[model samples]
Each structure stands twice: as structure tokens, then as C-alpha cells.
Target: MKLEAIPRLSLGYLPTPIEKMERLSAELGITLSVKRDDFTGFGGGGNKVRKLEYLMADAVAQGVKVLITTGGHQSNHARMTAAAARKYGMKPILVLRGNRPDLYQGNLLLDHLFGAEIDFLDPDAYFTEINPRMAHHAAEAEARDEKAYIIPLGGASALGAMGYVNAVKELSEQYAAAGTPAPRYLVAPVGSGGTLAGLHIGCSLYWPETEVVGIAVTGSAVPFSERIAVMANAGAELLDLEKRWTADDIRIENDYIGPGYSIPSDAGNAAIKLAGNREGMLLDPVYTGKAFAGIIGCVEKGSIEKGSSVLFIHCGGSPALFPYAGLLTSDLAG
Candidate 1:
């Protein structure tokens, strides 16, 4: 597929490192590797860095002077976008979805530190509410003759999905260099559905022999799968290929979405501790930790065959961890 149509923004750390986890692999009876997209070469890294690069690039291309996006109160995506907007000298306005609007913690603190303006919504509001709300604020900027751009939560547009497309492209080279076969399965948390869809479609075209697993961090499997199908097809179309995807091609796990989005689960907390204690790698309770929980459970249940190589995309959410300090600290005390 031609990659040039996607816009620019100079927001991400490119060609992130991929490494095998020998110790964790042995314990789980499977070879596990991780693509560290977390270190996206910017202020506090995450997968959003990749999406923002293309999304923001498009904004500037369209002559946008103000950029607006939204997420939960402690959303890593929002925090990173604020940092990115500042770095490129664009105005950032964020609409947050959370229960506590007054207390600035976790990514919210970073949002303020980055000087992103705030708008809050009730925690129980529908997931679709934030976008229109952000757009409304952007309208005010446009009235003043300042160009405004609206970026969706998690930046899950077809153009933004190209970031993960390039990610799989990067993986092909990494595996070839190490003389290891491309991982049989790639797992990542599904929040806004862009990253999972991008990697899945990218693998289909670039490798076509791998399975991409989605561990739903938010939303249900039914809705998540439907959304993924739409984006994957869009990505394939961009590549000028007509590929029909069947149900068998996508795997979504609802076994670990415990409680709700951004809340801590016991399994997720355990995975976080195990990863830190064993590999010295940190996972936030919101995304990566919950994703790892799914991995641990699936492997233990013999769902993923033993000896098969698995790769987890470590999309960073470290900024959300501090807001969850009560859980981690309590676990530590216990």
C-alpha cells in the first residue's frame, strides 16, 4: 500500500524495538516477545504516538491551527496528544470522560502540564459523546478564523491505522534480522479498535500467515469485532487489494475485561506485578496489564498451543498508573 497519503505531525518514535522475553516465555510454556511501541520516541511514550504522527500531519496539511481530542480523565492517548500538540506549536483542547473532574491525577496531570484545555463529561455517558463535545469546542476556534481539527479518542481513523501497518512492516525486518520466524500470534488491548485493526490487516498483507489477537480493554467482543472488520477492510482497500475477511480471521477475548474500562482487575494487577517483578517491565492497569492478564489466562488454559511463539504489543499507558496507585500499593503491602 502507498504510505504517503497519510498525513504528518512528527509525533512518534519510529521503528520501536522488538525483544523476546526468555524468562516469561519459559514460565508460560510459550515463546513470548513484545514490540515496545511504548517508547515512541516522545514525551512519555505509547501507541498513540504512531496514530498522532499521521493524524496531526493531516491536520497541518489541512491548515489546522487547533487540534481537539478526547478520552477518559487519565487517558494516555489524550496526555500524549497534548504533549505532541505542544511540541509542534499547535493548540490542543481535550474533553475528558471521568467520574472525578476536580482531582487532577495520572494522565490528567500531564494534560494540565502540557497546557491542554479541559471539558468534562459524566462517567456513565455513552462512549460516543466525547467526539461531538470536542467538535463543538473546536467550532468556537473556527469562528475566530483559526482552523480546527478534531481527532477521535485513541485516534482510530483509517489513516492513523497506518502506523500499526508500518509496525508489522517493522516486525518483518526484526524477525528476519534475528533469524526467528515472524511471531505466530500478535496480541494487543483493544480500546478504540484502530491499533488492533491496523496490525491485523497489516499482518494479512505483509505476512498473511500470522494471527492477531485482540484483548478487549473496553467495550464488548461483538461491538469490538464489528468495528475491527470495518477498519481492516478500509486498510486493505487502501493497499489496493480486495481481501474478504471471515470470522475465523479475527480473535477477540472477553474473558478479562473485568469490571469496566480503566478500572483495575485482580488478574490484571497480578500480571502487572509478575511482569515488573520478573522482567522489570511496567504495564499500566488500563491497557497493557489487562492485556497481559488475558495472555496469562489463555496460556494457562491451554487455549494458545504450547511452543507457539506469541508477541504482545506493549502499547504504553504508564501515565495512567499513578491514578491507580491505590491498587498497586495495596497489592505491594499485602
Candidate 2:
């Protein structure tokens, strides 16, 4: 796909390790392993760092002095964006979609530690309020003779999706080094769809045999698969690849998204505990926890065949765990 032609900064630990989970594999009746993007090792380390590598490079090239983004209160993207902006010597402004908490915790605490200018809006205003508010901040920066770059929700732009496309390339090399066939299925959480879209394009190019399964963590009025297909095609266009994706090409498990976004569900919390206790892997409630639960759901429902090889992308959100400590401890306590 000529991914090397793109401008990207070295912002993460390249080629994160893939580790087999022997204990969890047996329990699930499948050969299971995880790509540890959690250890990306920058801005508190997460999947977003992969996208920011390309995004920050563009921002620097454009002489952007202020960076603005929006997300929920405990968004890992917001925390990492603030960190990336600080690392690159730019001001970060977070216009989050919620009221300010009485006490900062989890990713919110880290965002403050990074010295980001933070604003809180009503949760109901998410779709309507985020862009206009960010534009206002951009105008203010312009008045001060500073250039501002507005990164979209979760860095889901076509250019940023290149990060995960590059990641799948890394995955192909890893499997080749081990002299093993690629897994039958690749699984990951789907938030803004950039990561999934990238994986779709990447797998199409490198690991065509493997299917990518997206676990949606949020309920959206617009179908996420359609959105993801559009994103994947856009990314494919950037890579100059002839392949295009349709909504039917995307396989999404939507049942695991319980209650609402950011609300912990019984199944999700149990999955978090199972991973931590069995595999010593820590996953948060918002993203990884729900996605992990989806893996179990798929296996139980026979959607993923027994004894098949499955690889999960651990996209990282353990920082958000702190904010949910009270509920988790109460629910998971023996």
C-alpha cells in the first residue's frame, strides 16, 4: 500500500508484542493471543498513539501551535492527545462531552496533569456541540496569531487510519517470523471506526485470509458498519489500493454494548475480572472490557468456531479503570 510514503513521527513503541494467553485460550476453547498495543509506550500508551504518530507529524508540518479534540470524560484519546500535544510542544484544548466532575480521576486526571485547557458540556450536546465549540477555540487561537489544528473525535480521519494499516503490516511480519499461519479471526473494539477501518484495509492487503471482527462499545443511530466501510474505502484510496469495502464486508458484534457508553455492565465487568485473574491482563470498562466480553459471547454463540485461532487487539484503556473503582470493587469483590 506504500504506507512508508506517509509522514509519520516515531511516537509509539513500534511493533508491539503479541503474546499467547494459554489459560484464557483453554477456557474459551480456542487458540487465543493478543497484540499488545497497550504497550505503545507513549502518552500513557494506547491504540490512539498509533494514529497520533501520523497526525502529529501532519500538525507539525502545518505549523500548528494549538491542538483541539473532543471525547467523553474518561476518554483515552483525550488523555493521549493532550500528552501528544505536550510532547510536541503544542497547547491542547479538550472540549469534553460531559459536565466537569467534582474530583478528577482516571484519564481525566491524566489530562489535567498534561496541562490541557479543558471544557465540559452537557452529555446530550455531543453530536451538536463539539464541532462549533472547537471552531470557537480555533478562532481564539487565530486572534492570538497561532495556528490551531482540530483533530476529530478519536482521530478517525482517513490519514490517521493509516496507523492501524501499518499495524497489520507489522502483524503479517510477526506471523511470518514465527513461521505460522495468520489467525482465522482478528478482533478489536470499535469506537470511532478508524482502527477497524485501518485493520480492514490492512488485512485485505497483508492477511487476506483473516477476518476482522469489530465489537461496538457504543450505540449509534447511524450504523457503525456503514461508517466504517466509508472510512475503510477512504483509507484504501489514500494507499492507492484498488480494493474498496462495503458495509457488508464489516462484521460487528453489537450485543455486548450494554446499557450505554461508559456504563459498566455485568458481563463486561466479569470479562475484565476474568482476563485480570486468568491472564494477568488489565482491561478497562469502557473499551477493552466490553470487547473482551464480545470474544466470549462470540465463542459461546458458535459464531467463532471452537478450536479456531483468534487474535485480539488490546487497544488499552486501563487508565479509565480508576474512575470506576468503586463500582468494580463492589461488584467483583469475593
Candidate 3:
């Protein structure tokens, strides 16, 4: 099955730009470039839009009327999913893990703006209650003659990962057009593993020599490498490809996740300032900041050799920045 044969609901601005991060490269003493997945327009733009394209396509094909998904309160995935559902004329229900704050800022605000029905849950109750509740909601919708399609957190299914496989193909073309060799390493943030998994499979097939590195933003609690391998294999099966991946195929750095998922780390805060000041790029403290911090750490520790070409996948979550204004502003000021 060719990737083109798969159903996709063109939700993003494809072929997002690849540009040289000259200042950042100079700072790190490497040939560094950035793939702006952040530029993927729709619901404030982020890497999640890619996955939603494939996921929502399947929903539409199955005659889905309500799209159900789970995420954290500030989940960029949830915000994008809600926007995509609205664009496709389907209702979106977001089962978010976190308290309903008196002030809805960042992605939560966007979720409301998109008119998604949101159910906020306590963090401890997320695993125990969210899935069952989502199922119940779907059942109720079905009873009302409305079909519901449940998308797991981060849209990390095999079908969703296909979006990044297609992205890898796009990156190959972009590299060729720019007359640059395929990068020695491709770095991205790993939240629920689908994007990294798709990149691993895509790199294995398209750019065999490039090592794909995933920065585990969720810490070691989630076996990201194992999950990536599973999703990659599943995505391969969906594409009717014979290749299979194992945990050994994935390279993930888990030490950079400061306190835990969604908690701002010193390195991440510094990274956010560095990128904004040096490259005029915005990286949310949750995902891209930590991932970029990993890249910087690698460069500083000589894990990435000097002069090596590197491509950092900027999976955007800039809107989430608004919620952390106090921490970021204070840190930046001090």
C-alpha cells in the first residue's frame, strides 16, 4: 500500500520549511538546520496536525460524527484535534487530564474557541477514569445515532504515525533541493511516540544513514523506544511494507526531562530563551524547549560531533507558552 493510497484529510500546510539556524549552528559549532513542523497551519500549528490528518481521515471514512480524544490540559494535540474536527464538520470531545483552571489559557483557551466539548479530570484520575468515561461518552453518542471515533492521547496510533513517514519523504526532497547531504542526526521531542516511530521507519527506508534521536519529554515512565518500535512496525504494516523495527532501532535520551512531564526545567527555560533570542524562534517550555535543550546538551558533551550536520524537528507548542508566562518571564529577567 502506497502512502498516497491512504486516506488523509489535508489539514496542514505541507512541506513545512527547512531553514538553516545559522546563529544556533554557530553557537553549537555544527551545521544545524530546523524543520519547522511548527509552521503547519491550523489550530495554532504543531506536529500534531500531521497525525490528525491521517487519524481524522479514517474517522471521516468510517462515517464518524463525533471525534473523541485525550490529552493534558495544555495539550497541543487536543487543540489541533478540536480544530481539525470542526474543519471536517465533526464534533470534538476532549477528555483532558488536569483541573479546570479558573482562567483558561493557552491550548485550553483554543479548545474552547474551537467549541470542543471538554471534560477535565484530575491528574491521578486520568489513567483510571478517562478512558472509561470517553467510552461511555461515545456509547451515549452512538445511542443518539451519532458515531464517535476515539483517538488516543497524542494520536499515537499506527495510522497517525503515517503522517510523519510522509514527512520524512518530504524532508528528503527538501534536502535534495537545498543541495545538502542527509543529516547525520534528526532530533525530535517524543511525547507519546508516534512521531518518533514514524521518523525511525521513514529514516530507515528513505535515509538509512541518518540516526533519529528522540528526546523523551515524558521522562522514563513511558517506554518510548519500545512504543516507537511498536508504532513503527504497525505503521509499516499499514503501508504494506515488509520492514520491522525493534526497541534497539530507537535512540532516545531521557535524562533531560527536568522535573517531569509538563514541568519546566532550568535547561528547558534557558533553551527557550536561547532559541528566541538567537534564532527568533519560539519553543514551548513543555516540548520543544526540552528537546532543543537535549540537542544542546548533546553538542556540549560531544555526543554529536563537531561539524556534523543536524536537523532539529521543531514540533511547535508556542501557544502553551502563554500559560507559563510567570515562570518564563521571571527566569528570563533573572
Candidate 4:
């Protein structure tokens, strides 16, 4: 598909390790492996680096000197984008949801460390007001003799999703080299939908037998599936591919998102602790924890076959855990 012809920035440590989780595998009675995108190693490492590698390349190609994006206060994507902007010599402006916290910790702290300009708005205002104002914000930067680029929430644009398409290819090569059978199931956390979209398209093309499942940390399955399908189709078009995706192709479980987005759920906390104790691996409550919980749920409900091989994409957000210490500690206690 001439994917190499696409322009991309050299960012992130590629071919991140795919290690088998022996303890977790035995516990679940299935072969469990982890795709450690958390080790991506740019701006404190995360899956967002994969997306930004392409998104920022597009920004730089457009001669943009400023990058603007929006997300929650502790958004891993926003944090990574800020770090990436600094690396490429572009100013980053983050329009974050919610008022400034009494104490800045976790990713919000890293945002300041990266020197990103921060503006806070109420959650409702951010979605209803600030989102539509992004172009205006960019225009204001232009008036100041600066070229600005607006990256959507979670870097979910078609261009950004190309990163995961490349990731799937990398993963296929890894499986081949290790002489391991292709996993029957691939799971990842879905927030803004781009990662799942790219994974679905890539899996369909590269490893057709594998079913990609997304654990929604926010909304319900049906609407999120539709959103992911749209992203996949758009990404296919961006790559000049003829692949078309529909909601039917997306398999997402919305039951894992307990309470609401960003609030620590009991099940998510347990998953985080389980991964920590069993595999010596860390998972953040907001994303990976809930996703892993969903994986456990799938096994319990017999959705995943007893002896099946599954690959869990660890999309990384360990830093966010620091800010939720009180909640996690209380939940884990007793």
C-alpha cells in the first residue's frame, strides 16, 4: 500500500517489547502476552507517541510553529503532545477540561515541566465551547506571525491513526520472528477511538484471523464502535487503501467503564493491583486498568476461549496513578 511513501517524524522507540505474562497467563488459563507501547520512550513514554510521530510530522510539514490540543486535566495524550511539541521546537497550548486543581500532579505536572501553555475550562464548556474555538485559537496565533496546528482530542485524526497501522505491522513481524502463533484476540483501551480504529484496520489487513476488542473507558459499545469504524475508514482513505470498516467490524465492551471517565472504579483498581502484583507491571486506573479488568471479565464470562492466546496492548499512563494515590490507596486498603 506504499505506506512508506507517507511522511512521518522519527519519534518513539519502535518495536517495543512483546513479553509473555507467565503468571497472568496461568491465572487466566490462557496464553497472555503484553504489547508494551508504554515503553515508547518519548516524553515519558505512552501510546500517544506513536500517533504524534505522524501527527507532528504533518504539523511540521505544514510549517506550523505552534500546536494546540485539548483533553482532560490528566490526559496522557495531552501530556505527550506537549513533550513532543517541545522536542520539535514548537510551542504547545493545551486547553484542558476542568478548573485548575488545587494541586498539580501526574500528567498535569508534566505538562508544566514541558512548558506547555495551559488554559482551563469546565468540562461541558470544553466540549461545547472550546472545541469549536480551536480554529479561532489557531487564527489568533497566525495574527501573531506564527503558524499554528490544531490536533484534535486524543490525536484521533486519520493521520494519527496511521501510527497504529504501522504498529500492527510491527507486531506481526514480532510474532513471526518469535515463532509464536498469531494471537486470536487483541485488546486495547479505547478513549478517543483512533487507536482501536487503527488496530482493527491493521489486524484485518495483516492478521485477518485476529479479532480486535476495545474496552471503552467512557461511553457505550455501539456508539463507540460506530466512532471507531468512521476513524478506520478515514484512516484507510488517508493511506490510499480501499478497506471499508463498519460498526459490525468493531467489538467493544462498554461494561468496564465503572462510574464514569477518570473516576477510579473498584474493578479497575483491582486490575491495576493484580497486574502490579502478578506481573510486576503497572496500569493506570483511567485506561489500562479498566481495559485489563475487561480482559479478566471476558475470560470469566467465557467470551475468550479457555486456551486462546490474547495480546493486550498496554497503552501506558502510569504517571496518572500518582495523582490518584488517595483513591487507589483507600480502595486497595482492607
Estimate the Cα RMSD of every predicted model relative to the unseen true structure.
Answer: 1.8, 1.1, 1.2, 1.5
lDDT of model 2 at position 250: 96
Off by over 4 Å in 3: 220-222, 331-334
Arrange candidates, best TM-score first: 2, 3, 4, 1
Clashes of 2: 0
**Candidate 1 C-alpha lDDT tens digits along 131-162:** 67877888899999988888887888788788
Question: For residues 20-43, could you state the per-residue lDDT of candidate 3 as single tens digits?
Answer: 999989999999999999999888
lDDT of 3 at 328: 88
TM-score of each: 0.95, 0.98, 0.97, 0.97
Model 1 / residue 36 / CA error / Å:
0.8
Error of 1 at 160 (Å): 0.8
For model 3, what is the alpha-carbon lDDT of residue 209? Answer: 94
Q: In model 2, what is the error at residue 329, expressed in angstroms?
A: 1.0
Question: Against the unseen true structure, what C-alpha lDDT does each candidate score?
Answer: 0.83, 0.94, 0.91, 0.90
Residue runs of model 1 more than 4 Å from their true location after superposition: 100-102, 126-128, 220-222, 246-248, 332-334
- Point out the worst 10-residue segment of candidate 1 by lDDT: 1-10
Worst 10 residues of 3 by lDDT: 218-227
Among residues 3 or more apart in sequence or in different chains, the pairs in candidate 4 whose N, CA or C atoms overlap within 3 Å are none
Tell me the TM-score of model 3. Answer: 0.97
The lDDT leader among the candidates is: 2
Please give the distance, in angstroms, between residue 37's alpha carbon in candidate 3 and its true position after superposition.
0.9
lDDT of 4 by residue, 1-334 (tens): 4567788897899989998999999999999999999999999999999999889889988888989998888799999999999998999999988888899999999999999999898876766787666777888899999999999989997888888998999999999998987899999999899999889778877898999999999864349888889999988887787889888888889889999888878999999999999999999988999999999999999998899999999999999999989987884577
lDDT of 1 at 21: 90
